[model samples]
Target: MKKRVLDVGNCGPDHSSIKRFLAKHFDCEVLQADGADDALAALRGGHIDLVLVNRKLDMDYSDGVEVIRQIKAAADVAHAPTMLITNYDEHHEAAMKIGALRGFGKLDLAKPATVEQLQPILGSAD
Candidate 1:
């Protein structure tokens, strides 16, 4: 069966770009959520194998770190791998501290050399 992925992002451009990339390479089902509640609901529904969460959401709510924590705290989904994406360089350390399986800043996503850096983490989620 194809692996499922939950992609939580408030920005349409970034969410669309990542969804396009993943869809091209993997049999990924993308679930776009605007906030923590939607993301959690998706996870509870049982189709998600991995998650790629944006570091910030609408109205400055639901950062990636909190999403990661919620996933880890959930008994059913704790084992799922989470990749946190952010535009802020400083949040890199914070993301790592929160137990994200992988963390990539927007600068890395902008460059082709590092854009595919998420492949390994996504692959491992399978």
Candidate 2:
């Protein structure tokens, strides 16, 4: 079965880009959640291999760190790995402190390193 990735809080364009990237490189399905509540609901409803949250939610401008905290705190979905999408070191560090794995910046989406980072979580396309 294909792995499922729940992408939270990214804008329309970013979501599209991430969906395409994951589909092409990881062979995974990308699910969308515009906010924490939707994200949590999706997690509870099904199995998600990974959760990717933007640094700042475009819909509400909420901190993605708080969303990551909630996911980690939730008993049902805590097992799923999480990654914060951001270019800022401080923000990435903050997400890691809250139990998120190392994630890549949008600017680095096409980088080989990004593919390497995701391979462990999502596996190779082939």
Candidate 3:
């Protein structure tokens, strides 16, 4: 079965770009959620192998950290590995404190280098 990655964000095309990129290279399905409620709902409804969170949410850009925390706290979905994606490099450290394996700043992700950077992290399902 293909692994599923839950992506929590609504940053317009950037969100779609990441989703498409992950689907193409990670050998996984990238599900999307625009806010905490939607994310939590998706989390409960599916078998997710990974969780990618944007540093800022559509509801409140600064809520991404808190959202990840909530995702980690949920008993049903907490086991999936999680990470934060933010333009601010600083959130990488913060994401770790909240239970993410690692974080990717949006700045780094925007570059073509992201494919190489994420290969090890996402670990191809193949």
Candidate 4:
């Protein structure tokens, strides 16, 4: 079975573009989550191999860091590696501090950087 990725964010143009890119390259199912609560609920549903957090989530939760923090705190999905997607490269430290494994710049999605960063997280560790 293809690995499943819980993509937490709003359905903006950029977000939809990234989703398409992910679907094209990665052999995984991308599950969309609109907010922190929604993301947590999906995590609870099981079979998620990765948790991709959006830096500017539209819901009241505001930031991806909060979403990452909550995912790490959850007993059922804490083991699922979380990554932050952002336009700013500087957010890497902030994401790490919030317990995200790492952060990837959204502009890098179409480039080699996205694959380089995500391959391992998507179960390419071997």
RMSD of each: 3.2, 0.9, 2.5, 2.5
Q: For candidate 3, lDDT tens digit of each residue in 1-126?
A: 567888887577877787777777777777888877888898888777777888878656666888888888888878778888876767878878878877666566545566666666567522
User: Which candidate do you rate higher for TM-score, 1 or 4?
Assistant: 4
Give candidate 4's root-mean-square deviation (CA, Å).
Answer: 2.5
Residue-wise C-alpha lDDT for candidate 2, range 69-120, written one tens digit per residue: 9999998888889999999989999999988998889999888888888888
In model 3, which regions exceed 4 Å deviation? Answer: 110-113
Highest TM-score model number: 2
Candidate 2 lDDT score at position 35: 87
The C-alpha TM-scores of every prediction are 0.77, 0.97, 0.82, 0.87
Question: What are the per-residue Cα lDDT tens digits for candidate 4 across 5-77?
Answer: 8888855776677778777777788788998888888888777888888888866548888788888888777
Q: What are the clashing pairs of model 1?
A: none
Give the range where candidate 4 is weakest over 10 consecutive residues by summed lDDT: 117-126
Candidate 3 lDDT trough over 10 residues, lowest sum: 117-126
Which candidate do you rate higher for TM-score, 2 or 3? 2
Instruction: Tell me how candidate 1 scores on lDDT.
Output: 0.70
Candidate 1 vs candidate 3, TM-score winner: 3
